[model samples]
Structures are given as structure tokens and as C-alpha cells.
Target: MSLDYDLVIIGNSLEASYAAVKAAKLRARVALVLGETETNTYTEIDRSTFNCLTYLDKKGQNLTQWELNYDFVTHLNSSQIQTWITQVKQDIKEYYSPAILADLGIDIIGESGEFCRLPALGFVIKNRTLRSRNYLLAMGSISSIPKIEGLSELGYLTLETLDLENLPYDLIILSQTPIGIELAQSLNHLGKKVTLVVEDSNILPQEDAEAVQLIQAQLEAEGIKLLVNCPITQVRKIEDKKWIQAGNEALETDEIILITKPTPNIKGLNLEGVKVEVQPQQIIVNDKLQTTNPKIYACGSIIGGYSLSNLAKYEANIVIKNAIFYSIFQVNYHPLPFHIFTHPILSRVGLTETQARQSYGDDIIIIKQNYKTLAKAQILDETTGFCKIITRRNGIILGGHIIGNNSDELINFIALSIKNNIKIQQFSQLFPSYYTISEILFQISENWQYQKLQENKFLNNWLETLLFWRRRWKL
Candidate 1:
């Protein structure tokens, strides 16, 4: 077509960067319009350096990649869970440099540019009259402000605002998502009176129900008031008081914060010439990340489905393969692992119990194990959670959910197992040691048999008591 440029990447986010790098490799003349600096911008770090742990392996030697991967999968699984982590780390190390684009003759534009549609070209934008051949829109989502009546009048802060670090507020009301919960908990831990409002019945509702219960208990224990099933009806300001009404009851909070929703940034793009469609807050794309305009593609939070940074990066790679290499590979969303980084984090992949039941009927079996009985969780002194495995009647592991200290890292094991069709019997056969949380999988896998043996209650109690005594005596 011989257009102005090969590809124009609209955002400098993780997904956008990935797409840009892939496009560059295809020898596409690329341009990046970045709103912020690229170095370490999206990475999360622990600010409490004093509490961070530096561990030494049993050999008292440095750990190798194989060691880390072996230990990780030994505790978890070897499927996409490991692949996703490895790819992200590899991508960051190999292609994360901002200067790489410039070195490849890709132009970097600092200011924000809006998209426009012209008669000849299906989609286009003007960077002071310089148009591009293909447009890759990745502006990301904007924070959603609840229609609180007085919120705007009293002033508020969002993730974007809080990211600035200058717009100070005394108190912040947050939602239950990672951004909301993490910020609220962090500020509260730093002496801010933050109240987390969850319209859903529980925090991290998408997580395992048991995980959600454990996290809710932990958050409540931390003195964070969790208002469940109470939607913020109105936010109004009276004099200096910021009043928030949930249903009929009114409460006053100092500041209001809205978490971002999955909304496409195509408002002024003028897509009249293109056949792409957007509903409510997102763009419609097929499994291949292809838009209605066959020649165009989309990825990241703009698509409204799975919006994790890792998922977006995967989608970006898919787009690159399809667009540049003309490969027929499609995006597979099965066994997508996501983590909620609350205090006792929650992580899940595949179907929940509710989902499995609806999809596979009541013949589904759920295996569960407690963390208190696990040696590692007990040793870590964080035994408030458990792992639940959902399987079909024939013993296919459908999903895995974990809610506890290392659930974020551990859920991948279940994800890998499910993705690879690893059966419950195989998992049980591994026979992980007693003290590790991974043992929970083995414990649950054998739970059906244990339940049958529980017919003799007294004998079971006697056996449990004997085991407890033996462990206690050993200690």
C-alpha cells in the first residue's frame, strides 16, 4: 500500500511495547506515542525493603534457572503457568529497552495523538500531517468513576491521580480490585484511614470462593471495613462533609477513588470508515484479536476480556504473528491464570466451582485441603487459606483455585495441570512432602477416599490424634 509509516503504536504500555517490539522485528517502520517514560514504569516493587526476605537454598549456593523452574513446577505445574512467567521475564530482559525502538529507526512521539478516519484510508491519525499506514490502538482503559453525587464536588483521586504522588488526600475510599485494594491497603498500612467498598458480596469475587472468604477475614482482621453487597448509590457534598449513600444508609468519607474499568480508548477516533464495533466499553475482536476491519487488530484492556499485563503481551505476540508473519495461530484463553495481590493474595485459573457445576453438571467433584495442615504454611505462620481443585466426574482437573500467602505463585501449578489435562491421580502420585502447600493438592486428590474412611468417626479421630501427637513429639 506504501503508506506514510509501517505501523503506529498508540500507547507505550506493556502490551503496546510488546506489539511495537514484534512489529520492529518484522521490519515495520514504527512510531510510538508515549505518555510516560518506559523504564520500570509498569513494574510493581515492594517499598518495605526492611521486611523483604533474602533466602539461601539448602545447598548454601546461588539458585540456577533450572532450580527455580524445577522448584516452581514441582510445587505447581509445567504448563502455560511456567511458560507465561518465563516469557514475561524473557521479554522484559530482551526487548524492554525504550531506546531499542529508536535504534531500529522507529519514531517516538511524546504528545498524545487522536485517531481520525478519512475517505481513502479506513483509519488514520495526523501527527502534524504525518499519517501512518497501519494503526495499532492501545491507549488502555481509563479509571471508572462511580456516579457518586458529591464525589466530583468534594474532589477525589483515581489510580492515575494517585500515580502522580502530589495530589494529596487524607482518606481514600477504594473498590475490591487489585489497584483499589492494594492502594487502599498500602495507604492504610501507612496510617491512612482507607475504607474498601465492594459492591460484590466479597472481595476478589472472581477468585475461589474459599480464597475470597479467607482474604475477607484477613482484611477485616487488618481493620479494613469491607462493605459488601452495598453499592455506592450517591456521592454528595454538603458544606465540607462528603456524604456517600449506599442504598438508603448514608456514610461520610474524606475522599473518593474510582478504579479503572475495561473501556476502549476509541472515543474520538472517528471510525466511520471502519467496520469495527464497540459495545458499552470495549472493542469486539475475534479469538485471533482481529477487529471487524480484517486488516486491523486490537489487544490489551481495550478488548474488555482478559486484561492482565501478561495476557495482553500474549495477545500482542499473536497479533504480530498473524499480521507480520501471516501465521494462522489463534489466541487461546483457556487456563488463564490471574492473581489478586491482597495481603493473603488469591490466584485462580480455569473454571470456578460455580462455573464447573454449570458447565459439567452436578457430577463434578470438588477436592479441598486446608493450609493449617500444610507444613510450609504452618511454618510460614500464614495458615488462613486453602486450595480447591475442581474436577469432572471422570477425574479431569477442570480448575484450581488457591487463596493464601503464596496463592499468586501457587495457582499456576493448578493452571498448568489443567491446561495439560493432568489428572487428579497423576497429581496425587507425585506425593509432595507434608509441610509444603503443594501437598494440599495430593491431600485433596485423596480426599474422596478419606471421606469414605470417615464412616468410623472414632477411629478417624484416634488416627488423627496419633498423627498429631507423633508430629508434636518430633517437634
Candidate 2:
């Protein structure tokens, strides 16, 4: 069987679905071949695990209702989030309507798509026979498995299957990530022995260090054994006893969980015939999300870019504008905000101190403020993290990183600041009052710019003299 359309989206994700919907709206005939049942499969997982009711903090104090509510409420008020919610809703209403998609000649082939070959033109997707087209591969990714001996025989769960219900087990060994950490914490709170092994220096390595530390402390307080810098080498189950080997040591556990990396789900699609290149584990795509062949494009996790759902959606928008409308839209990932859904949540945008230092130099200034100093954080009893801002010599906001309650929501303001190249003084002037964690940026700006100048003796002396003269003149 053969069908023709202006565009054929090869995955049913937030990215692919939105792209299909937008293209159809632009009066282009589109089709979507989906491997999954729905657009937001990961979102259907039990997010209640991240709720404060699941675990306790370092002080052995249970998370208050206010703290959870505050985080939830603040997330609703985020500027970046409002846009996402609106876009997603619009896309769903348009594409999900059978009449609209049918009217636009948009066909959704709900099947587990397989790649047949990589030809000189594009990949051939085979359900049974060879299906070729000007394809947009958005097949997404799967969790990476560690090369551990006997792991296959012992049985393990990836992030995709970790939330299976009513599975009784005495102990669970988790490789740390957002999903792994939340699972470990939730299981531990539910009265299970959970050991979390992190290959990185911290649990959420992508998050702010202070935030990682706070989350680590909280997990440890809840009796979650956190092993850092240790790579699991082997897993074997002998006579119902599971032995996990990690760095010259063996720990016995009932279950093992992998959260290391996510492999792109593009193996079955036979790409060799189409000659579309697949390097290592990712598909090559240009700024416009086009593959080597101009007619073919790719997006989402398959492109090996930022794996956040929101980022994928953003890329989808760009693809629709460029591919269908022929608009001069290019993908710009700068100031891309990310959030780690831990208890207090860790969020960041633009650059980190390490990244900024690499781009700039030692002359860069870092301003750090603790969440304890924030009135709302203290009142909510979740003041365990801090916010750090990286700026240049001229007080240009280089990046913003926050590890505290509502950090995910708070990072949006910083994302906007970095996007607009808003200066430190401008940020301070706009947000002068301390109403919430969002105002913490302004508070940091007030001290950060002047402190750098004060550290320079010559500049400090000149400023002091100028201040004295102004006082004498009463100006």
C-alpha cells in the first residue's frame, strides 16, 4: 500500500504530533506514523512520587503541605510554562479532532514503526513492506543499559517500566537520574530498602550543585544508600540471590534499575537503503532539523539534542514553520530551560558557572544566595538550596541556576532575562520587592554588580571619592 502527503511525521510524540497538527493547519496534507499510543506517554507515569509526602528532608521533618502546594502553584504561574500549555492545548484540540485531521488529509497510522534501510534519499519504514517517503524521524529514545555481566539473566527495569504496579520486592537498586531518584525515594518511603548508585559525582549532575547536595542529603536522611563515582560492573542472580558488582565490591539486592543513558529508538528502521547516516546512536540533522537529504527531517530525542519534552515541542514548532510554511525558522537552543523533578526541584537556563567560565574567563563573577534568606522559602519550610547567577565584567547576565523550592518556575524569569540580554541593574530595578522566589534574582543583582567593583581597589577608591563629592554637593 502507498500513500502520498505533503509531510509524513514518523513518530507520535509531543514534537511529531504538534508538527503534524501545525502542518495540517497550514493546508498541507500530513500523516503521522506513531510507535506509541499517545503523545505524552512519560507524563502518564506516577508523578506523585515527587510529592513531598513521599520522603523527608535532612532535618527529619516531613515536607509540609504548603511547600508542595507552593511548588505546584508557582509552576502554574511560570511564563514559559503558560506558552507551552497554550500551544499544547491548541495542537491537541486541532490534531486530535478526527474531522480536522481527516479534512486536512492528515492520516495517523498507529503502529510500531520499524526502519528498513538507510538509502541514498531517506530511511524506509517497514511495518510489513517497504514504506518510503520524505520522512521526519522523531522516534524518540529509550534508557541506556550498562554493560553489566549477567544483567540480562537477572532482569532489570528501565525508566520506562520502573513504575509497574503491585510488584512486591524487598530491595531495589536504582541508577540515579530524575526517574531513578524519585523511584528510590518513593519506594524507600513506602518501607522498601532502596540503594541508589550514581556514576556521576552527584545524583542530578545536570542540576545546580547546591540543589544536588540538598537532594542527596534528603535522600540519605530517608535511608537511601547513595553510592557516587561507582559503576556497576555485573549483576547475577544465583539461587534467588541477586549479586550486583560495583568497583571491586558486591552488593546483594533484589532488583536493579538502569538510568544511565537513553538509546535512540531507530534501530529497526532500515536506513541503509535510504543512505541516511546514523552515527553511533543519533541521527544527523541540521539547524532546520533537516537530515542529509533536504526532503527528510528529524527531531526530538532521535536528534540527540536536549531531551526535555518542552524542548522537543519547541523543535517541532520550528520544523512545522520551516518544513510546511517554508518560513525562515531555525532552531535556537540557547536559553533553553530545564528542570529536574526532585523534591525541591532543580532548574537552570543559559549557562552554568563552569560553562560561563569556559566561554568567558576568571573575570566572570558568580553571585550565590541561599533559599533560607527568602521569606517564602522559609515560611514553607523547604529552604535547603540556593540560587547562583553568573555574570560578565559588565554585569550582563550570563546564566542563572537555582536549586530550591519552585526553582523550576523561578528559572523561567532567568531564562527571559538571558534571552533579552537584560543587565543586572535592569533586573534589580524591575523587581525591587521580595514577594516570592522569583524576586531572589533582583536581590542577587543588587549586591553582585557593586561587589565586583568594590573588590577592585582603584574602582572602589574612585567611587568613594565620587560619593564624597556628591554628598558635599548634596546631589
Every model's TM-score = 0.75, 0.80
lDDT of 1: 0.65
Give the alpha carbon lDDT tens digit for every residue of 308-403 in model 1. 777788788888777665648798876778765556566778888888888989778787887888878766667888788888866788888787
Name the runs in model 2 displaced over 4 angstroms: 1-3, 35-105, 111-133, 174-178, 200-211, 325-329, 432-434, 456-475
CA RMSD of each candidate after superposition: 10.4, 6.3
Assess each prediction's global lDDT (C-alpha) against the native: 0.65, 0.68
Measured by TM-score, how close is model 2 to the native structure? 0.80
In angstroms, the error of model 1 at 461 is 24
